[model samples]
Target chain A: MSTRTPGTDDGSAPLLTLLPSTPGGAAAPAPERADAARNRRRILDAAARIVAEKGPDAVTMNQVAHASGIGVGTVYRRFGDVSQLLWALLDDRERQFQEAYMSGPPPLGPGAPADERLDAFLDALVDRVAEQRALLLAAHSAAPRARYHSGAYQVMHTHVAMLVSRLRPDADPALLAHLLLAPFSPDLMHHLSVEQALPAERVKAGVRELLALRDRPRPA
Target chain B: MSTRTPGTDDGSAPLLTLLPSTPGGAAAPAPERADAARNRRRILDAAARIVAEKGPDAVTMNQVAHASGIGVGTVYRRFGDVSQLLWALLDDRERQFQEAYMSGPPPLGPGAPADERLDAFLDALVDRVAEQRALLLAAHSAAPRARYHSGAYQVMHTHVAMLVSRLRPDADPALLAHLLLAPFSPDLMHHLSVEQALPAERVKAGVRELLALRDRPRPA
Candidate 1:
């Protein structure tokens, strides 16, 4: 009735893949059905399209269902709730970003110098914050209301910490991680961009210079 | 009848000493009667006592009035509202700290080397954040709700910015101001101490090491 994977779930990757669904629904279904997978994909695609058209606040179950050409119940079945849907969206984004940088191309993913990679990371991060500020705010606000704990931010911080540790073994990774994330801090970014009337590119440039300082050794 | 003096009201230090009496009423006083000055001193002393005991949040107008044995109207007369009272308290503390550093002694004051002053500034700032976390948070929270514009934080930032610019003239003062303030950023500090469980002293050590890197020029 039930079978277990040897070491898959125990690892720290957080199991982005669908688990094998077991009999009596003990595991997940041992594996997702082909049609189930298709429906899940369609729901997510529709949700993203709606969010893109309006904003995260405007994307609703009914809208998603309409866009996916499915019943609202199916959307609910895939995501369980609105908060879960938002988490799924953010998690999907986080995973895609990680994969791209970790294995993608010369500048950001791999094969570039550590300094260049660091600069690219800041630039990409600022751009992402500018484009996704509303969605990011929604995800964080929804965090307090989530049924289950959201480990999405923790995963992203850990990934950044590891990269910083690898790039500069002697530096304090925790501080580095905080500094790396500072540019994307919601209140600060909003205050600087909207309140202070600073251009996004100038803000990114300042962040890039700040990170560049970390690459050098301390002067006497 | 209205009265004026060479050093009164317009643009001199005595402007602070001259307290405006009941606006619409006939002029009741000149040079602020001795009793009013004594009461003002008593109020400031009591305000500090209340803040030290109950924190900035709990130092209510009625409480300060009661503690100083002054009328509630007098408290309101002295400071327009609760936020003004709290800001005055913090401003008093910051003023003392600035005086000590600008001309008081070595290390934190003018006698130390520029690099050592920078190092000491980071250490003192981290320790200040640790000691006055509650006041800092209250002041920051109250800033958004304040009715009157007081350029208090701007003054503090400018002081620190000047110190940083002197230390690193080649660096952007505004960005350096942000970087220097990073360790003291309330969200970052709270996250590091409460969520991350880092010992306060260790975080200060990390900051010291981090700021030490500011002096070195990045390789071309």
Candidate 2:
């Protein structure tokens, strides 16, 4: 947990911050905390490396500790379980994405046309999936609960639903929400990317075509 | 297995009934023929009774045997396995439906506008799912191999893909096939019907609205 400082939009707080920890040196920990912060960063960075290299399922607390050059007890102290560690990794990624889309200019955020925003959102989503391709696959194949009810999934549904509502006010917003997220679904993405060996660009193209076809008018 | 008389449909051989042998039939052995047939009839009747009373999961082989005053091995010999038994029961129901939809009348089968066929197919599908509601639920909760690769699913997809192609020659027929079937997926249906407690008619109406929305022209 990161600590919170007032008027800071840097997206971090100190240890025990509600969201993510602020990385600045302004509110440096007054307690025996500088070492802990360093340890936490080391653990997270090591976890990410292990996840990227060996996939999420292959990552164990002992492995993270070994990779981070810390005692196994420290890894357990940082993240209580493998599930929590995996979740934290995904949450951090999703939070960064949401901040980008919400505050960044044009297409993904609020400065561009709804149509383009929809397209850009789809592209960003597919790219994110591609980047975390290995971890996402491992998590899902492990259990339905691991995949379905994660905070990342909830955030995605909520974010996509908001965008769909903004973009297509006349549509069945909830169903549209489902449709928008459908392409990024685990099963569909895995089928396209890994199984079909399709390039990410192709999936993005299909998304464009789906949007066009879905929005097309009926024959007279 | 029921034996089909060769070329009966082509008028080269006389039609012969192919259902499981009943009592006083020529296929029966002389000793204990009447008793065996009677027990078989009793067992099937009890199986149906148990399913109707307590749903598909409750119609276990042991239960069926006990209900019919027979041994468990008798149940096993008759059905081979629970999956086979379940498939047999559902196949009996599905044959009636396939016959009706393939050759019966307008709207559902042929002789109607292509759009009407699409609409009627959805209505019939929802109705069938609702009619066999318990069995459908049981099947989904069962093993994946038993649930997903059933011949029924293949037949439905093929039937739907064929019809949608005819209806929308300019459309991406395969994608439309998925879109059309979206409203009837077991997960979707269960989510709408059970979790949401939505009226089946209202769900059907919503589906109709969705199709209309899909068919509407895009904003230029």
What C-alpha lDDT values do all the predictions have? 0.58, 0.59
i-RMS for every candidate (Å) is 5.8, 5.0
lDDT of candidate 2 at residue B79, scale 0 to 100: 65
Model 2, A1-220: lDDT tens digits are 1223222222122212222222221333356578997887788789889777756646666667778999987777777766666656765566778777777878888788666776788899889888777656545444422332455655566666676676646555565554355446554566567765878887776555445443334447
Q: Positional deviation of B61 in candidate 1, in angstroms?
A: 5.3
* CAPRI-style class, candidate 2: incorrect
Per-residue accuracy of model 2 over B1-220 as CA lDDT, tens digit each: 1123221122221111122222111232346578777776677678668778866655566666778898877778866655555555656566667766777798898788766776787789888777666666555433222222455655665777777677656655554554455446454466557765777787766555445432334548
Sorted into a CAPRI-style docking class, model 1 comes out as incorrect
Cα-based TM-score, every candidate = 0.65, 0.65
**Total backbone collisions, model 1:** 7
| DockQ per model, Cα | 0.09, 0.10
For model 1, the local distance difference test gives 0.58
Q: What does candidate 1's lDDT look like per residue over B132-180, in tens digits?
A: 5665554444332120123434444565677767765666767556545
> What TM-score would candidate 1 get against the native?
0.65
